[model samples]
Structures are given as structure tokens and as C-alpha cells.
Target: MNCDLNIYCDESTHLPNDNQPFMVLGAIVCPVNKTSEANSRLRELRIKHGLPAYFEIKWNKISPAKVDFYLDVVDYFFDDDDLEFRTVVAGKEFLDHDHFDQTHDDWYYKMMFLLIRNVVPSPGQAFIYLDKKDTRGGEKVRKLHEVIANSIYDFDRRSIRRLQIVESHHVALLQLSDLLLGGVNYANRGLNSSSAKRRVLNRMQERAGITLTKSTLLSETKFNIFCWQPRGNRP
Candidate 1:
């Protein structure tokens, strides 16, 4: 069997009119055989924190009371050798849907490609999990799956086996994506309302040895950041 990669994806401030400075798409990648171990480790984190077995890990739920628990989760991600994350941040300041002759939806799919560039191994199949973001229909999601598969030149769509919408609460790795992506979005936008959130950001800086305020090096493997800006304008 081809050893596949499982990618748990989540996004922050994705709405076209949300008025946020950046739209962040982040993913957690793990080898096929290691998925269960990753899930178990995250579940253990919840138990370590006294959270209920059913507790749903989330970025927006971080607070003073739960800050330490969240920090430990962050640390686990950094310490785990089998896990990896990458993010692409697109600024909305000078974006024009009309200029690209694309609907906001179309632009989103394109950005998704950039977010995973070089992250997917072509020789191995990839399974992508996205948080349930819309109920309009499944057709959009289906189209996105096709687009990605095609971009990878997987015309038969075999290399990329699946791209499905899932509830974040049930998926530990997806929730991790939410937390890490939230910290990136918060730090980039200069929002520091929570000390715990700031702590995660600072910790990431200390580990990555790069400021989170800008794009990371193209070759950064553990936590890669890609900043997307308008061609003629400063981001």
C-alpha cells in the first residue's frame, strides 16, 4: 500500500467581507500510519488538562482559565517529530475580485493551492480534512477536490484520495490547525488581547527563530508561513 499523508485543514477569517486583514489557511500533516498516534496524543492533552473526554479543542475557546492547557497543546505540536504545519496568509487590503475575474469562491480555491504548495508528496496519496465552513451545498467542496487533484496532475484523482468536510470537534488534528492558525492570524494582525495567545505566538517565535509578523523562509519545514500580498502594494 502507498503510505499516504493525512492533512487536517482549517481556516480563519475566511469570509470575503469579514473585514479581517488576513485569510489564513493552515493544515496539519501526518503520515498515514501515524494518524492514530497523533489523535491519541491530542486526546491525551485534553485529559492532562482535566477537560472532558468530549471536550472540543478550539482556538476561539482559549481563555485565561484554559490558557495553560492550550499552551501545552502548542508545545506538543512543536515537540512531536511526526507532525508538521504550513500556512498561507492572504491580505485583503488591495484585493479585487473583479481584477482576477474570479468570484471570492474561486479565489479561495486558488489560495488553497498556494497554501499546500510543496507540502503534498506526489508519490503518496493525501487525504485532506476541512472544517465544515458552509452548508450551501457539497458541490463546492466537490469542485475544490477536483481542482486540487488536477493541479497536482492527478487527473484520475488517485494521488489525492479525499478532500472532505468534517466537524472540527471530532478531529484532534483539525482543532490543532485552528489553534496554530489562530495564533498566526492574531500575531500578524497585531491583536494581543489574550496573554495566553501571545504566549503561543512568542513560543512559536522562539522555536522557529523567525518573527511571526512576516513570511517565513520557503524552506521552513516545521512551521512554514507564506504571506500573499497584492502585486503593486505593500502588505
Candidate 2:
């Protein structure tokens, strides 16, 4: 396993009773080799777009002109020819309307499974950065990691090997990435119910020309959202 491959995971939500899809979990995995370049590009983008360094931009704050600028930044940085990003969206239905359930856990686990399966990283180090959640701290993450390890063990059919799940609150780069993804989520939300929007799904198929499998309920659920793989690295 090589010491590379950092997976940045984040979720987006529209909030209560809006009838619009509110939550999305996106993972942007890049090779360690490109981290520096990505960061540099992000810094340049921040300057070019005049967005605050640590602040998150919401739809209401962005006018049409600013939206154009923001999209340009996405095209500039995310359109890179050397990196790949995998996004997972968990809509309100997946979570049972914000309440946790076995079904929800199954959906969450399946999403994680799909994300990792898509990456298919070789025997190398993998870093998973999850956005803070209620069960994200202390025993919860630990248990979640345990569940992931067990799942990996079953998937690999061998003893669990290498993987790291870390909780981070102060990583500015990740925060910026989260904001960028949020913007994408926001822009993509179209005529779907206010509780959930299918824009991202539509955009991904439209832009990337990648069709998701319908056999899987998750894929079907995400059909309305856009999902993309970053340009360069595998998995």
C-alpha cells in the first residue's frame, strides 16, 4: 500500500419540511501527489472569486454574476485532468426523514461501500475524512470504523489491513471543498420537491455521460443528482 489517496467526504442538506431534498454526502478522493497542486488552485480560486477564506456561501447570498464566477472556479479547479472525485448523495428518504433507522444505516453503509468500491484503490493507504455528524464523535466514529473494517474484511476475504478514518474540524482546505460541493448541490437543485432536488443527478449524467446502475436502489434514488469521478487517479 502506498502512502497516498485522501478521501474528503461532506454532506449537504436543505433543512426542515421544505419538501426539497436536503442532504448529500460527497467524497472527493485525490492522490497525495496532487494535494499540493489542488490546494494551490483552491487558493487562487478563492482570490479570483472574492469568497471568504473560511466562510460558506449559500444560494441566497450568490447573485447570478457571483454564481457564474463560482461555476467558473469549479470548471477551473475541478475540471483538472489529473484527479478524480466520487460523490454520494443521501436524500431525506434514505434517512427516514432525519430519524435514524436500520434502513438508514444500511443506506449509509451501502453508500460508503459504493464509494470505496468505485475507488478500488490498490494496497495503499487510504484516508477518510467525514464531516462532523452526531455519531461522528467518540464512540460513534470508533464503532463506525469498526463496522467499516468488518465490512472490508468481509469484502477482501482476509484480515483487515490498512485504512484510516479521522475526524477533522479545522482543515480549511476541506472546509473549502465542502463549500464548493454545497454550491454544486445548491445550483443543481431544480424542480424537484423543495424537500429534495434531482438536479445534481441530472447534471452528472448530462455532463459526464456516466449512467448509474438502476438495479441498486441507491443508484435509482440518486438518479436525479449528479455524480462524478475526478480526472486522474483511480478509485
Candidate 3:
């Protein structure tokens, strides 16, 4: 484990009964040394847009008023060579947890593993950070660390170094993850309510060169996505 990487993870519409049709798990992968640079550049972009340096970028906040700023953010992400995004989009309608004898949380952790497995490099170390969602944040972190470490056979916890919860508002990379994840979830749900959101999604599709509703090749590294299906579900 010579090189180091940082993974900022986030999710959208993951609740069991949130009336949403899809759940999205997303992450931003950056080399440990490039984290600071990326954060600084994002802040600079905020200032360039006449917003405060501490302004938190979020998907829900996207509107016609600030569409250009958000568009610039999308362009910055695709232009940067040091940053990469990956997500797992799963339809909740296809879920049958009882048939598999697994709780929703168990399935979520399993998806977390699948989401990061392709990005975790061999002969390197990774530190994971998930957005703070609720009071069970600590428990989720512990379970996620255990599952990821065990799946990688990192009993000694050397390769998978640290897993913790962080506030998305305070972490630029985590905020970026939320924005990208929200866009993917919005696309998969086949909704076109907001023109601003539609523009953002269109920009992502143009840059990634794949329909947001479909899965990309496993080897695609820059803007990778996996559309997960249940055991008996058809594509």
C-alpha cells in the first residue's frame, strides 16, 4: 500500500418508504494529495460566481437563477484529471429483501461495497467518508468499515484505512458527490420537472458519453456508473 486515495461517498432517496422509485449511491475518488487542490479550486469557482467561498453546492439548490454556476461546476469536474465519479443506481421497485433474507441496511452495505470495489486500486490505501445522514451515523460507519474491510480481506485494516461520517456542507468533495448522485437519480426516475436539472443532466450525459439510465463498462474510470438489478429482474 504505497499510494493513497480518498473516497467521498453519498446517497439519495435511500429510505425504505420515501415514495421514491430509485436509490442512488455515489462516490468521488481522488488521490489523497489532490484533495486539497480540488477543494481549493471549487471554492475559487464559487467566488468567481459571486457567491461566498463557503457556499455549499447541492443538487436541490440548483435552479434557473444559478444554473450557470452549476453548469460550470459540472464542466470543472469533467475537466479535472485527478477526480473521478462512480455511482450505483438501483430501482426500489425491484427490491425483494425478504426473499433474500437480508434487511435493507444489509443490501445497502452490499451496494456500497459493489460501488467502491471497481475504484479501489490494488497495492494502494483508501480512506472513505460518508455523508452524515442521521443519529445512526456512527453505526452505519462501523458496519460499512467492517463490510468493506472484510470483503477486501483487510483483517488488519491496513489497506482500507479509515471510514467515517462527515458533514456534506463542510466537505467540497462530498458535496460534489451529492450533486452528481442527485443528477443520476433524477435521470433514472425519468422526471423532467425542472429545466435546470434537465440541463445539468444533459451536460453530464454529453461529458460522460452514456445515457444516465444505463450502465457503463466496468473498465470506464472517469465517469463510471452501474445500474444494479435484483436477482430475477431483467434489464
Candidate 4:
């Protein structure tokens, strides 16, 4: 089975006790054949902005000095039709894990499923790469693979070919995922600490034609957002 698509995923402020009220999980979906070209353009963008080729595009690293470059990167993503993004944002302040009979990790896996469930096309195949978070992340990766594969009934694992953890710096697309996910996280958190970050987020909002804080139509292919609302009574 040929995996025609590649999905690079990243998460921001997802820790259960990170003191952050919101968490964002996101993925960059790109055609396998266009991956090389996409990376090439990103590299070019970096060089064009006087950044080293090896410099990673990280949202946290954005500053007034580099705002223009980051804004261009945002535009590049939207200009390229082959690139698409989808994210799941959750407000974690009121989660009742005990009442739900599940751990935070379990809910995390469910969020992962929500992020990609609708992005996978019918009769299409994809390989998922997640940014490595910690030492135990390998185990989480395996479990997430199981959750997704089972959800789609891909018992043979053909439709969802593989799921693995990768270092963000090693994968250009993963870094891009981090930037895009960061914007959603920042917007949802209602932060204004960084003018540079706000500038970048404004560019993204303008290009996508939607406020990042709210959920976009699921059918919105270019920049899809799902604001997950937790249900059920608390214990």
C-alpha cells in the first residue's frame, strides 16, 4: 500500500499541570510527492530572510527582529495548495478525568484521534510523524498508533501505514507544525505578551480568513480548527 500523504504533528501546552488553561494539537498534511519541494521552499525562505539554513522555524523563537520572516513563512504555507493544517484545541481547566474514568494520557490519545480523523481522505493512505516530547513518548506513540488504526479498522495497517515520533529539528515539516499550532494556542490563551507573535498570528488569521480562537468548518481544508467542548457531568 502506497502512502500518498505525510502528516507531521505537534502539540503545545498539553501537559496536564502545565498551568496553561488550553492545549493545542495540530498536524501538517502534505502530499508525499511534494514534501521535498515544500522543504526546499522553506529553506529558501529562511535564506531569503538572512537566517541560516539550519535554523529551525519555531513559534517561541519569534521576535520583532524576525517577525517579517515568520510572516512570510505563514504566507508561504497558505500559498502552497499542497499544504494543509488541522488542529484540535481543548480548554483543560475543567476536565474531570476521575469522573470520566480515564487518565489525562487517555484523553490525549483521544485528542490525537480527533485531530486527524477527518483529515484522512477516503481511499487514501498516510504516514504520521509526531514531534518527540519525552523519553516515554515512544510508548505513547505506539498506543496512539493503535488507537488510530483501530478507529479506522485498518487491521492490516495499510490505510494508516505508520506512526512514529521524530525530533522537531530533524523534520522541517514538524517545525512548521509547531509554528502553526503555537498560533492557535496563543490565540486561545488570549495572550499579548509578544508583539511579534501577535503579528504572526494576525498574518495567519488574515490569510485563513478566520479567527483562530473559534472552530472553523470541518470542510475547510486549508486551515481547519476544532474547538473541542467537553461534555458530561463532573464528579
Lowest summed lDDT across 10 adjacent residues in model 2 is found at 213-222
Q: What is candidate 1's lDDT per residue for 1-235, written digit by digit as tens? A: 2358898888999898898988999988889899899888888888888998667778788888888888888889999988889998888778888876888888888888888656777678888888898894387678788788888788897887878899888888888899889888888888878786777778777876778668878878789889998666444
Clashes of 2: 24
Backbone clashes for every candidate come to: 0, 24, 0, 0
The positional error of residue 17 in candidate 2, measured at the CA in angstroms, is 8.5
TM-score-best of 1 and 3: 3
Instruction: Kindly give the stretch of ten consecutive residues in candidate 3 with the minimal lDDT sum.
Output: 226-235
lDDT of the candidates, in the order given: 0.83, 0.50, 0.91, 0.90
Off by over 4 Å in 3: 233-235
Expressed as tens digits, the lDDT of each residue in 64-160 for candidate 4 is 9999999999999999999999999988878988988999999999999999887665687888999988898779988998899999888888888
In the range 124-196, model 3's lDDT, one tens digit per residue, is 9999999999899989988988998888898998988888999999999999999999899988999899999
| Candidate 2, residue 179: how far the Cα is off, in Å | 5.0
Q: Comparing candidate 2 with candidate 4, which one achieves the higher TM-score?
A: 4
**Superposition TM-score, candidate 2 onto the true structure:** 0.61
Tens digit of per-residue lDDT, candidate 2, span 1-235: 1335776666666243546553455566667787778777766666677765533433234444465544544465346754555555444533342343345455555555555554534666566666665544555455445666666563552332434344334553455446445545654454343222233333334444444321223332222234433223222
Q: Score candidate 3 by lDDT.
A: 0.91
